[model samples]
Target chain A: MNAGRPTGTRLHWWWVVGAAVVLVAAIIAGVMIGAVRLSPSQVVGSMLDRLPFVDLDTGLTVRQEAIVWQIRMPRVILAVVVGSMLSAAGAAYQGVFRNPLADPYLLGAGAGAGLGATLAIAYGPNTGDWLVDPIPLAAFAGALIGVSFAYLLGYTVRSGRTSVTLILAGVAVAAFLTALQTFIQQRESETLREVYGWILGSLNTAGWAEVRLVAPYVVVGLGVVFAGRRLLDVLSVGDTDASTLGVRPGRIRLVIVIFATLGTAAVVAVTGLIGFVGIIVPHTVRLLTSASYRVIVPLSILLGGAFLVLADIIARTAVAPAEIPIGVVTAIFGAPFFAMILRTSKAVVS
Target chain B: MSTVRFEKVSVDYGAGPVVSDVSLGAIAGEWLAIVGPNGAGKSSLLRTAVAAVEFTGSVMVDGRLTTTLTDKERARLVAYVSQRPRYPQGMAVFDYVLLGRTPYMGTLASESTHDIALVWEALSALRLEAFASRDVATLSGGETQRVSLARVIAQRAAILVLDEATASLDVSAQHEVLEVIDALRSSHNITVVSAIHDLTAAAQFCNSVAIMDRGLLVNHGAPVDVLTESVLQEVFDPSIRVLEVNGDPVIVSLRSEEAYQ
Candidate 1:
């Protein structure tokens, strides 16, 4: 036992610092090593030139500038934002449910997004421009609708919004939504490949607009979750104990679910249903740090961003010129890691 | 000087009242033990003080009606430790105890230095300082009970409501825990209201005892007055015998005559 402070608290700060350093290194690597390999100086010079008041000339050609700015940068940024959102949302879900197996998609967000994307591809007006894409908006609406329907079902059945009932409701809602999506896909076989590709999850079409679309929701949602960290800790003691400790566990759980769903829905809307990051990042963070939400939430954000960026790098480089879907990459590694966690760690869903 | 009073408190779970018209009070610095057999509503009555379950009548903490107070205000006045409370996996003992300081923290803030110091004090009080960094999920039944007690001690509330807080502990650990609580009541004047199953331990530790049967308060007074042989026979078992041991009541259950035959 360390004097002056709890050992968990001391070690958490070190994890945060280490995660931050790794994230920065991953970002630099993501910028430099892409389809077109650029030197470190070229990547740095291009980024500096794009900064508001900086006019640095490193004699890089226009093609090089477009490759760095227009292609790689937006994809990297989108990966970071999406990964952070999913992992933080997962951490919040686990805390609220008091189950480590709980993930962001436990509330039917993925199925809803799938249905929304299917509908958009099947019947949405053909717009050639990527900026005016209707898939993300439709997917976002569908995700919200799916989660709301599940919440309403759970609320009506239990009258108390207990976590177990809510999860069961979500499972039912997801199955129904997936069946509807399948029917839609069958009716419009022309868009089958498009729907399947989107469902498999890819970051190939990522651009600045997708980044802008998801930023505000992720920022606000993360803020809400961070603010409720202490309450989450109290909630883990069970509802009655939390109530006696001055926390309204029901209200805190609801607020956390809403914000986590919103952030997760926003990212899944653009990135498609990227699996594993949500479950893997938060669980890994808990292993590295204590189970306290105060440490888990921030570290989830940092390490999650780095994990996805690294995954994307491998997705693109492993079979170069023919990029593998990112969801496949995450599952390839996440499945074994998750199984190992279940076998060895006692700090899982209880 | 904080007092907890229940004015005709009744709790219902849709069918009917589990605890009916129960009126009780615990004075400042008093150790009052509520004793009864299973389904006697002892736990329900204790829970009413913390508003854990919805109740019909009023519970006043210190002079204010508990219904009128905010959750935070009510929490600052009373802390409840439930029987068999759930522990989060991988939570450290120190962190679990520090959660008791939730009432004292701001909405977006963490525990203060003073709060951490109180947690340390609580841990040391229960002799749990050595296990401060250990995972709560990894503790034994008795150690977990002590950790639960340490958490409420860190809460620093004027009144503590424990629902069978020591049911899991062995004989010696139970004595050690009750000793710590007795020390707290005398030195800090903290009022403790616990739902206890062990009659002899309750008689030894508590200054006053309340007897309940079938959702009603049958009798309440000093332990010697309430825990009589006749009352034990009626409320618990017909074969129970109450004897005096060092001026405190000790209850023993005699084997039935049919079993001997």
Candidate 2:
């Protein structure tokens, strides 16, 4: 065999560092530029004082501390966690399906969550308890059911299970569930506003509780996805090719879909339906680096978190006292970027 | 040094068996070609050796039953190259070839320097060094075919199972690919079993040829013996003439009666 020069192995430390720096800057900007504007020093000082063994006196008053710590910090952290989860899920979905256009919501997760939240608003007991947040709980259950149904439908349609058939099944299930959600809204028109608000997606109601609720799922799910990154690359080579390489494409795809769905459903349950973060972040990472999932998955988490935090800042401050849905801002920017990607890259879309 | 053996192997995809009781072998460092008309179960028989389809009886690689081996162990012993392999968008040719190291690397571990060196060697041997950075999606038909072979080369397996590996290549590219495989077979003492449609190419390259018809292996011997005019006419149902040019058989198809004036 002819021995050529060793090819360059990817060194993505720069990409990781760049994304982390941007995330830190976005967090600082998110905390400082809210309605009750706090200076950069105040934000840093308050944060440092909260750290263990660092009780440095902050120049801010008690009300300002509450606004910074209680209000903005939790929202910023929730944005980071939820954004990372959604974008990572999107990357995994695209890899598993072997389709560039696939997103976290490709398998009826969005429609299922919508129906769940709608049902909660229409018939669930009216309560103000954070522990018993019926909307999120129902939405989580609904998302799981929706995906399960899609998988079953895909399985039944043919003896051999292919990704194309599964995606088509997901589209069918999403359409059916979406119609049912709309019908429920029509029956109880009073719940229309609440359902529409949740579907539109927002970070306005973010709190420390939401952050704590989603952090564990995001961490565990991301760990599974990160470990399977190389396998994802193997899988992108098609089932027959992957099999010849000693990889079980069916088993790996199932594991990836389960973990990605769990993380996506948990976050979508809480954050409603945030669009474009999953597709946009992963696509941007692919454009900058190679299409190896090893780089795409991790970078998506870091860059996605930063992207959502920045979008949230605009969502709240773009029209002070009245917030635009976080989804709207992402779609506004992401749609155009997605169009540009399609126009510029001649790579295989499938 | 590995030899592939199939004894009474049968495969079925719900609608009865597509390949039945087919037995064959490719000794170490030799090339075996299976030639047949379409729907003659040639591809299915090839797939049976790799465990890609559910099959009965036994397929032995180097005297060990393939069914008894784990997927990784089997992959280490044998590598498969499909006729048309899928390529991911934006995947560099280097990365695509490096995937052949999958059986050797741990689940979570990335490719090491040694693994990457093997990939570079395979690419260079195939004259694919210039296309290393190019996207697999952007490769020409012949180049894509070579890249597929390069991936199998990177696997470093002792035996190769190829299904119509050069069906899409032009005559010149076909000869180049076969020459590369010939060189590798001699250097590495590797065994190759290919299912090809080109009878002339098979007679030129392979030491042995197996003819199949209606899911059964009908004949197996030296290429000159098995690729006779009668066998080709019977199996392929084509009116063809086999001529010996410099001791090599060259197949020529005659026009049908309806087309003749």
For this target, which candidate reaches the highest TM-score against the unseen true structure? 2
What DockQ, on C-alphas, does every prediction get? 0.70, 0.64
Q: Candidate 1's residue-wise lDDT over A1-350, tens digit each?
A: 33655633543557878999988778879988976788878777777787899999967788887887788889998999988989999989989988777888888898999999999999998846656688988889999999999888988984565778889999999999999999999999999999998988888989998899899999988888878777788889988899999888888888999999999899988889899898899888787566888888889899889988988998899999898999999899777976787678656545
- For model 2, the superposed segments whose C-alpha errors exceed 4 Å read A1-11, A48-58, A129-131, A340-350
lDDT string for model 1 (B216-256, tens) is 89999999999999999999999999988888889999999
lDDT tens readout by residue for model 2, B67-164: 88888888888899887888777888999999999999988898888888899888888999988888888888789988988898999999999999
* Cα lDDT of model 2 by residue, A1-350, tens digit: 33455363374688889989999888988899976888888888888898999998889998998888899999999999989988999999999998888998899988999999999989888847555789999999899889999988987885788888899999999999999999999999988888899999988889998888877888888888888989999998888879878988888988888888899888988899999899989888887777888889999999899999999998988888899999999998778877887678755344
Q: Which residue pairs does candidate 2 place in steric collision? A: none
Residue A204 accuracy (lDDT) in model 1: 90
Worst 10 residues of 2 chain B by lDDT: B45-54
Model 2 RMSD, rounded to 1 decimal: 2.1
Fnat scores for every prediction = 0.81, 0.68
Candidate 1 fraction of reference contacts recovered: 0.81
